[model samples]
Target: MILTVTLNTALDITYRVPRLRPHASHRVTEVTERPGGKGLNVARVLAALGHEATVTGFVGGGTGRALRDRLAAVDGVSDALVPVSGPTRRTVAVVDESTGDTTQLNEPGPHVSPAEWAAFQEAYAGLLGSASAVALCGSLPPGVPVGAYATLVRAARAASVPVLLDTSGEPLRRGVAARPDLVKPNAGELAELTGSHEPLQAVRDTRRRGAHAVVASLGARGLYALTPDGEWRAPAPDRLAGNPTGAGDSAVAGLLSGLLDGEDWPRRLARAVALSAATVVAPAAGEFDAGTYEKLLARVSVDRVTS
Candidate 1:
């Protein structure tokens, strides 16, 4: 079973407008709300792919209640969140059809107290024991230590379970020290983690930081991964002409699902790239069309890089 950790879960709101013009009032034609946070998104995808996954974290307030309800509503996924003192976060994304660009607004999550942190740790420990593989995802919420994911990685290692980490900034920097089996970082996050503007070089740089493997999401360039075996690239099927907000999360879901199936590195990379492109073409945030994903899966091309 897969265990997904999301310390800062949210209600993600996505709006679609015909065009984005600065300082101009625009009417939204579409609106979507989903239970979000990287790990929750992972669980959602895992469920869609027919994988058993349990999610844990700090969830509180009315929004937290809604999030739990929504997550539970999705079949084959379960949550074991520890209730905290403050409300969950809310994130918004505005997509413009004409330019296919998305403008995002994010809120810093509520502060977690010491007691809440302790309870979360206890819940996570229990969840970790039951997991075959664990995915620690998303950003560090206020009051959580930067090395939180690192600690979880170490625990997973001790339990002999592979750990996948997906996050940004200092949390990622510190987490890599614990040597997670895999790390998924989008291009911008990869740049921050590896300090290399050249993306392929940044992927190599990530491996040097102790991740057993690094899957770097290259947006339109598709997926680039560097593992101990070798480096590989999988391009998306043609070019997608839509909002691409949740592409990376879909790619993470692909990688973990591939790993759970015992797929080789190349197949895993192809699956990730294809799922990401499908998410891009699907429209809205964190949503991928099943049919598009299936079709794109066949068209994704994976190649080895031996330089």
Candidate 2:
């Protein structure tokens, strides 16, 4: 089973409007809510791909309970979330029908105490024992240590579990030091980490910082990966148009699934790119259109990069 971690768990709510205009009242056409946070999003995609994924991290109060209830309904995903004293946060994503673009507002999440963090460590350690691979994802919530992912990566490494670290800012900087098997960062996040806007250079820099491998998500263009085996660029057949919020998470799911199955870089990149594009066209976050994924999987072209 794969383990995914979302330190700041949330109830994701999406609102759809005909168009978004500033400071104007508008009627909402639709609303969709689901359990979310980066790792949860990854778990959703993994489960949809017929993989058994256990979701862990912090959840609390009424919001947490509601999120858990929704999670319980998802197939192939097991809830092993640690409870805390504070309430789970909520994230709002407003999708405009006219443009199919999304505007997101995310809450900082509830504060965790020292004891609660300790409980989480114990829970994570136990989960690592069963997880074939682990994904450490998303932002750090208040009161959680900045090096939380680093600590978790170390534990996973000790247990002989391959780990993927997906995060940004200081947390990512520290986590990479633990030499996770892979790190998935989008263009912007890559820039923030390596101080380079050039995706290829940033990915190389990140690998130097400690990631065993780095996969840089290049939006509609697809993924650029730098690994010990070799470097490659996997581009989508075309630039897909739709909401791209959870696309990266889907890519992470694809990569993790392939990694655990011992697939080579080309096949993994093809799957990652296809899954990411599928999520873009899907109406909701953390979900991919199965038909679209199947159609795009063989179309994605992976090209080897030579120095």
Candidate 3:
């Protein structure tokens, strides 16, 4: 089983409109809601790929309850979320149907008390015992320590479980130093962490900082991966227009699943790129179009990068 940790869980709400204009109101044609946050999104994708995933995070209040209700309906996923006093947050994504653009508004999640944080740590440690691999993902809620991911990474390492971390800012910096088995950061996050906009250089710098391997997402260009075996560039066959909200999470799911299956770096990167592209064309957030995924999996090209 794979364990995913999302400290700041959310209710993801999506609105579809004909078009979006600055300072203008538009009619909403559709709305969808789901349990969200980086780890939760990853868990959903992993479940869709026929893997058993266990999600642990902090959830509370009405919005939290609603999110949990939706999560319970998802097959192959187990809920192990801890409760906090403050209400969980919500993220709004407004999609422009005409232009295929998305505007996102995110809320700062609930404040987590020290007691709640402690309880979560205990639960996480126990979960590691049964997990083949673990993913520590997303932003830190108020009152949680900035070094939260770093702490979790150490726990996973000590338990002999391979860990993947996907986050940004200081949490990511500190987590990377904890020497996670893998780290996946998008372009902007990579620049922020390494102070270099160059993907290859940034990934090298990140590995030097302590991550055993680094997979940098290059948006439409696909993925750039630097692992122990070698370096490779996996590019998408074509750009598909749709909501790209959960693309990175899907990529994370791909990488984790590939690792468990003992796939080589080339095959793993190809799978990650294909899953990311599939998520872009999906109708909803945190989901990938299965048909698109199957087609792209065969089309994604992985080229080894040579010095």
Full-model lDDT for every candidate: 0.86, 0.92, 0.93
Name model 2 segments beyond 4 Å from true.
24-29
Instruction: Write the residue-wise lDDT of candidate 3 on 1-307 in tens digits.
Output: 9999999999999899998998998889999998999999999999999999999999999999999999999999999999999999999999898987888999999999889999999999999999999999899999999999999999999999999999999999999999999999999999999999988899999999999999999888889989898899998667487778889999999999998889988988888998999998987666899999999888888999898
Give lDDT tens digits, candidate 2, residues 1-307: 9999999999998899999998999899998889999999999899888899999999999999999999999999999999999999999888898987788899889999999999999999989888899999999889999999999999999999999999999999999998999999999999999899888889999999999999999886678999999999998657677777788999999999888889999999999999999998887666899999999997888999999
Candidate 3 has an lDDT of 0.93
Model 1: which ten-residue window has the lowest total lDDT? 278-287
Candidate closest to the true structure, highest lDDT: 3
Quote the positional error of residue 203 for candidate 3 in Å.
0.7
Ranking by TM-score: 2, 3, 1
Query: After superposition, which runs of candidate 1 have C-alpha atoms over 4 Å from their true positions?
Result: 16-31, 95-101
Candidate 1 versus the native: TM-score?
A: 0.93
Q: Residue by residue across 26-94, what tens digits does model 1's lDDT show?
A: 999998888999888888888889999888887888888888888878888887888988999988888
Assess the local accuracy of residue 241 in candidate 3 as a C-alpha lDDT between 0 and 100. 78
Clashing pairs in 2: none
